[model samples]
Target: MAWVQFGHAKCGSREPTSNARACRLEPRKSMSLDRFGHSTPTCEAWTMLQSMRRHSQSFLIYVLFGMLIVVFVFMFGLPSTDSCDPQTQIIVAEAGNFEINDSDVKSGTMRTFGDTLRGGDKEFKAAQRQVLYNMVTTLLVAEKAEDAGFRVSDDELRQYIVDWEKGNPDQLRYISGGKFDKERYKNFLDYYGLPTERYEAYKRRELLARNYLTMLETSLVVSQVEVRDLFEKRMNRTDLEFIKLEPMHVEHLFEAPTAAEVNAFLAEHMDEVKAAFTANKSEYSTPAKVHLKEIIVQKNDKMLRQIGTETDKAKAPDTRFKILKKAVIDNSMAFDEAAEKYNEALVYRANGGDRGTEELENLSKQHRDALGDKKVGEIVAFETDLTYNVVRIEEKLDATETPLDKVQSDIASTLIKAERADKKMDEVANSIFERVKNGEEFAAALEAVLYAETPAEVPPVDAVDPTVVPDDANPADEPKKAEEEAPQRVKVDVAETGPFSLRGASYGSWSRLPMIGDAPELARAALTLTEASPLAPKVYTVEGSRVIAKLKKADTGTDEQFAGQKERLIQTIRQQKSAALLGDWRSVITLSHPEPSLQSYGPWVQALFDQAQESGQFKVNQAFLTPSGSEVAANE
Candidate 1:
């Protein structure tokens, strides 16, 4: 037979040619011998091992394929960075060398507008146009600041943040669904594409801008005179001395009126009633009010003893514990009464342990619910820590109907006084108009008429001159009348002597000594002196009362007193000029940028204009309001 020869176990054998060869057979390299063919056993074994290796390789390949599939599912299948749809755009405005963007507008304002228009699909689009003007203005200011090379230090920014956080702990409630929630804060930042670091940076920039403006304004001088003048002009400060007429105390005038009497009064004075009502509807409208009260029974040692007694009954060893328990339960009925009568901490003791009426709003929630639908004098019970409250509904008011009746008496009284006032005013005005026209000296005529009409006497000689009186004079007897009689009246006169400066004009008019009306006329006349001018009496009449006043000893101090005000005036003048320029520029800018809107920023812009006018820092550009109602360019 033709046999394959293999050296050193190169050939596979069922029984090795040597024992060593059988132990270490080279299966991969050997050939198998069979009855039908000359094939080596090592060859078959090697083929089987190769098949097993291929299966293992296939398993690993499957695992790698699965891992790649999982990675793709986690990557593209999950939420993408761009998935949250945000319709956002940032617009910028250039102010000289620097630029500012939409983000410069306060976040609060932007969010408010957003929330207001959130329902409609086109809201965002509308908001873009509506917000553009304010955004541009804010951005321009911010950019101008940047160009000025103003920067806030990190420490300053941190301090400001701490201050803001302290002042506005409640603001966090709005930022986080009314809770101190971290996730809400994070979501808010994430939605705006801002991290904590960027948020702080923005806040610091805002603080810096505010500080810059404050520093710019405060560094300039503001005089006491300037402040006082501003206060005098803007604030309505009047020194009034009048006894209030109380109808309630003087009940004899209105004990009981027949229906016909009331009707006759109403009918005779229809115009007066209408005028009073028209001028003062507010006085006739009643305020929303509630009547509520609280009963407080505080816990103290006596109550603690009672509680201990009950506990002792429950824990009694030899005594009849069940009987003691029953007795304690029966005594519990009077626990509230005991608290009111004997408890040291009880606050209410009078009116059968009653508390007075309190406002509904002031009542606690439980108290309000307890009082629901209860009528007057209806006693209801509620529990407290140490006492049971027996509350009586003392009063209730229907919102609409109740106010009308409550204010009717006030309305009627107001109407009557107003009628008296108008008639008195007309009488006084006509008198003044006639006296001035008749060549009567205004100040002299005022004092003479005032003294003649009222029971006011000149001050006593002792009051006027303390040094002229003698301590040894008789206590009861009066001094003998002098042969020279007292002057019946005093004369007042006016003079034009003044510093005659712009600063003087700002204080209205000044006087060292001023005349007064006789006591009866004094209170009425003060209200008529709304404006100060060349010396003349200011006379006022209200409800049979008359007052007379005259300017005396005028002193308009020099502008040296307003030295500190000069710098502030200069800045205010500059701001006025800038504002004027802005107002004029707005028309042209709005026309150019028709897509955006410009709103009326009133009072704020107008205040600067008014100040400049009064301070003589502004020139009237009469051409600005032309016959054709078109604005013209102004310089100054």
Candidate 2:
């Protein structure tokens, strides 16, 4: 009897008694055989059993092949120690098939932190996450640029790096302590463990991203009507007639808030109080401060004589400052003692020349620059317009928040007093405003309600010369008689008492109006009035006083003036429109291609290691995870 296996070579051996060739068949061929030792035909049941045996044999072979592949992968292929290992090549984010990884994040962090990682691990991790997001976004932008056929040549990229370095020479100087040393800069990169090639690649990416943004910004077009409208709004001017009623004038009429009143007010406006506190907490807290001892020498004759040297010519006025500066630099005297001996300003000299703890923002620019980054006991000399100062930093204090408990009482009292005063002032002002609206003159209404007085006129000095002596008077008695006689008033054509011209006042110019008396709210209120309804609808508080203003006149410029500014106005409008368009484009791109989660790639790599450790598919090298002696020493 002979049998065949489906899709396989038939047995050729002549060993009929052996079972080795019992069901074998030749490759690419199939045959049917009888199962009851009959050569002619087979029964249906026997044929079915033969078919089932062939299929089972094929299924078993497929199962064994799959198992072999999985075993090979687990034993050798999956646990790769090479750079191409799936673990090492895990993708943090993908921008059009460009995979971001932990190495990329590490490079970015190194570039950003340089030699000084300011806030340690927390700052580094935060910066790394941000950098990863930025890198992914930039990569997407670069891809878009490439699709648009934009290409940056090697020479162009090199030139951009050069320009960037040139533009940031001050940053380099600061890092190198006022010297640009290539070796030192290289060492700094080494300290951060950033490779030169990786840094250059980052710079290239930045250049490409910036170019993409510029392309979008430059495509914006602004209309002529927009330009003209912006011009008119910015350049049109007005004249105002205003009456100012100060809170000081009416504050005496209001009583101070009693304890019960304060508590009641706070209870009524608890939400407002909390909101105000949240908004203005920084104002109550003191910022980082430094206490200084200073010596100021004015540019005067006395200062010049003390430190100046006489030659064939007269002594130079600046010589004294130079000498004093040299003396301080030479450490001939302590800063506090020097300030006491040389300081000309009496206010600072009383307490060992102490300037007290002052916020850096409060100091003059020169003083701030001299003291910035200075350590205690360090002396610095800097000059202002009229004075030469030598300052010594006595102490430095970090910023601290003021406890709410301490300030709560004062805040409550102030808020309650202000609220009561505002209500009282508003009632008085509203009554007067109603009268003005009902056809009473604004000046008369003010006078009736508040007894407001018109400004007194001053006689011109030229009209009554104090130096002149009358010819008919006795010389000795004439002086006394002239002094006793009232000076004759000069008739001057002054504008109506309240009428002040802000005709040339454009945007932001109202603050410069001398007639408004340092009240910005008054100036703003005056600007809002129109010729149709000259009177302001509401009274405003300015410098603790209530104010109401009328817009006497508004002069939109003539066509001739508009023609002169048309070109400049168009340029300004173009810039404004371009910025808006750029902003929109940036938003669209960022939204369309969102960044991956901000879980830093470093942590992701660590998580992979953790999973690998659990599965036993890979063994973690403890040495790689442990810091080297040098690294530990450096951290210490």
Candidate of highest lDDT: 2
Q: Write the per-residue lDDT of candidate 2 for residues 311-380, one digit (tens) a residue.
A: 1124343565566666667856765566556566667765767989888778888888778788998888
Q: Write the per-residue lDDT of candidate 1 for residues 422-497, one digit (tens) a residue.
A: 4544454446435644656655444443334421232333444434555876433332232123323332233222
Off by over 4 Å in 2: 1-92, 101-122, 143-208, 219-226, 252-417, 437-441, 452-533, 541-545, 552-636
Model 2 clashing residue pairs (backbone): 8-25, 8-26, 9-25, 9-26, 9-27, 10-25, 10-26, 246-545, 247-544, 247-545
Query: What does candidate 2 score on TM?
Result: 0.41
Number of clashes in every candidate structure?
11, 10
